[model samples]
Target: MDGLHSQQNVDLEEFRRRVQQGNDPHGPVRETLSRLGDRWTPLILMILRTGIMRYTQLLKEINSMADSPVSQRILTLKLRACERDGFIQRTVIPTVPPQVEYGLTDLGQAMVQELNRLIGWLEVHEVQINACRAEYDAH
Candidate 1:
């Protein structure tokens, strides 16, 4: 038991050192995950990837995702955060109803490439992930 514990500690220390060495063991990936992990953010980005979309269009797109239903208030908050982070830009048109469209900035477009890569990785490994989960649960 003590030997196993020591081995785990050594593994953890090695991971910490790797991260501290700017090996980016997780920093960039974690930062992106933290930003895009919000249920609506990625969905919003995916929707805007097609083209600029109005707030209503975003709401509808998000609603179609099914499992996670973002409320209007939450949607507003997520958009504001994304805008503040320079991930997305909001354009307000001078119209009677005040038309607002959201689109990805150049920075946001770059992020989409990263997101696409991550999604592709997940697609390839999804079965493995599910199998691991099943194995763990079976234990």
Candidate 2:
């Protein structure tokens, strides 16, 4: 079993080296990450994870965060990008006053489980992460 695992690891390393050397076996994955890794995308995704929300609500919620208050221009750009990437759906309500709401698409909802897992991991390891940061700063 250990020998099999070692062989698997070697194969993975070789694959990674080949990919790094411009033999991209996974070009689509790289492209997707490149498209989605903008500054505001993750924050928008995180906020929408709660549920569907109106545009103003999202803006206010983002603004309330001290560490990352997304500018209106950047938020507009990110939302448009997400829409183009099929990560989210935007709806406009027809009424005396128009209302706009945003929610995750099917593909975006698929990410929630993984996102939750990541958040759980962060919560579990937060103490260690903070300790490491403090130790590094003190050095």
Clashes of each: 0, 0
lDDT of 1: 0.86
Q: Could you estimate the TM-score for every candidate?
A: 0.76, 0.71
Compared to the true structure, candidate 2 yields what TM-score?
0.71
lDDT per model vs. reference = 0.86, 0.81
Tens digits of lDDT, candidate 2, 23-102: 45446556457655656677788889888999989999888863868777888888887787778899999977999999
Off by over 4 Å in 1: 1-32
Candidate 1 matches the true fold with a TM-score of 0.76
The list of candidate 2 runs beyond 4 A from truth reads 1-6, 9-28, 31-39, 134-139
Judging by lDDT against the true structure, name the best candidate.
1
